[model samples]
Target: MIKDYVSDITFQNLSHKHMSFERVFRNIEQFMEKDPTGNFKLMFGTDSQVFSRETRFITGIVIQQERKGVWACFRKVTIPRRMTNLYERISYETTLTEEVVALFTDEKKDSLIDIVLPNIYKGASLSIEGHIDIGSGKRNKTSIFVKEMMSRINTIGLKPKIKPDSFVASSYANRFTK
Candidate 1:
């Protein structure tokens, strides 16, 4: 059953008895990895404005309950200054598109309700804030800066941290690839 969820969606199946959160992350990482333009602006750009605008950042947030769990790993990929506004716009657009897709797909629609909806509130929303650095200077310091920024944003009464164990791809997701 969990394998079904892993399909198309990047995830790893750790165990049959338990769901593996790592799979979700692996998939998310893979998705972002496939993107060639992650921090290109950060590297070879001449303009400061251009540098700041095009750095990639990623972070994971979660909500946990005794009987339920919700996790979302977000990749805040920076685009060029020209594309910043469009990127933010698409950031919002992607969620809407997912909702529409879920709405149309019968099985997904039901799963969203039966599985995803119950764990998440009707209007639950989480806006994670993280920093994007162009160069690799002071990795520890940079990481702390991003984490601190993200912590300030309230996750709408959701749990602060939830980590998954392992990852295995779902059969459904595998079908599309190999």
Candidate 2:
């Protein structure tokens, strides 16, 4: 299920509509290069929507600086069958997000880090995170899987964020899941 969506996925943002992951990586580098002293955050997340005959899962990758603009893109995965199970859908979403997060290897991350390292004394910083749509709230159905999902992200060494704070998944990615 994972490979089906990731292997040949195309990422797109507002300016570009058809881009490979490699291109997206370069865009990230370029965005950082433009303002190396700004505090930057790189985030990955996934959200899904089930239709009558299929389910559409969208994963988004975003980089931004608070009060500044953001560079973002998403890839969609469609499953022929409907996924009625809440837990299964949520789990797969997490898996999808994790797989994308893994694409940024230590060296790749360090390259981005290196951009800001020189200006750290001036408050330049970078933080990478995995965003989960689940939130621990009375009305949030995904609250049940918070622990498991967060642990999954933690296992991969990426900081995890949930709803309200997890705009990448619940907001950005969700926008395209429809």
Candidate 3:
């Protein structure tokens, strides 16, 4: 069932609905809360880093499932005025499946995390294991890479622009590689 939704999703074309960070996180939080299993955890954090001679904000959110003494956790790192991606490798447990492994690889190579800023969205994919796990009580700390792309869309409305073909066509500057 999850795979069906995953396959149907054109991740690159997420509607650019102009929403407050609070609204975005709140919507995501609500979605996570509807888990069938009565086990969910949410935490938010913030940090600062220097970029191009200026300090910028990096916000992170962690969601986890703890049931039957097992745990599955996914962390999303986002920068204000920038979109997020899950293509880099962080850390993960050894007991993982091929499909999950492939997902990370594809994400690194061909997936768009989020579209942020003017004409820029973060992109890249890396293979990190032991950070993202499926089923029961497991702990993984996978690191994903995100890039900023330059484009011509103003993502500030509830019905944000979503054009995958055009989005993938834009050029990126200083794309980070591993």
Candidate 4:
């Protein structure tokens, strides 16, 4: 059973009325075909905001091609009120990102993988980046978990990016969590 159900997702920059996980991959492929020369980066990230009764988690997938702007999709999930610890919240956010990545990777296994694999393995500059909300700034409380969270993301074979650089989480998804 899917414990964390995703409700009401949409691609922020697309005109399409409805968007699903499969559609997200399809849109990326179509974008690649339309602009073969453009440098493309796929990013996945999650952020959360706590309310009095629940915690809202927002996960986003962004496809960016150099100079051509960006296309993104987001899903929001709400869970019952829980712990307020910073570490626990960050860890939960990471888990949400991992879940999204797994779902997308699994969906890409049959058709999209063949097309994406070449770009990925042939040094074509195409890659996937996992953006974490943690930062290294002195004023940021999440900074302390940078190393540990980065290590976790690295173990999953994703290029991890922390704040100042992790806009997918800190900016895009963060907006929806509110």
Number of the top-ranking candidate, with TM-score as the measure: 2
**Global lDDT of each candidate:** 0.26, 0.90, 0.25, 0.78
Comparing 2 and 3 on lDDT, the stronger one: 2
- Model 2 RMSD vs true structure: 2.5
| Candidate 1 lDDT score relative to the true structure | 0.26
Tens digits of per-residue lDDT, candidate 1, 49-135, equal 124445332222222222233323322223444434433432332232232123224452243233333334443222221212212
Give the TM-scores of the predictions, in the order they appear. 0.24, 0.93, 0.25, 0.82
RMSD, every candidate, angstroms? 15.9, 2.5, 20.3, 3.5
Q: Model 4, range 1-178, lDDT digits (tens) per residue?
A: 4423433344443365457666777787887667555677889898999899899988888888877888788767788995489999999899888877876554563344455555654544467889999999999999889999998878776799998899999999999888
lDDT string for model 3 (53-172, tens) is 333322222334444221222212223332222221111111111222233333322322221112232222111111111112223122111111111111110111111211111111
Better of 3 and 4 by lDDT: 4
**Cα lDDT for residue 124, model 2?**
93
Among all candidates shown, the one with the greatest lDDT: 2
Q: Which ranges of candidate 1 are over 4 A from the true structure? A: 1-70, 82-106, 115-178
Q: In every candidate, how many clashes are there? A: 10, 0, 38, 0
Candidate 2 lDDT, 1-178, residue by residue in tens: 7555544778887689879777889999999999899999999999999999999999999999867899999977899999999999999999889878877879889899999999999889999899999999988888999999999998998899998899999999999987
Ten contiguous residues with the weakest lDDT in model 2: 1-10
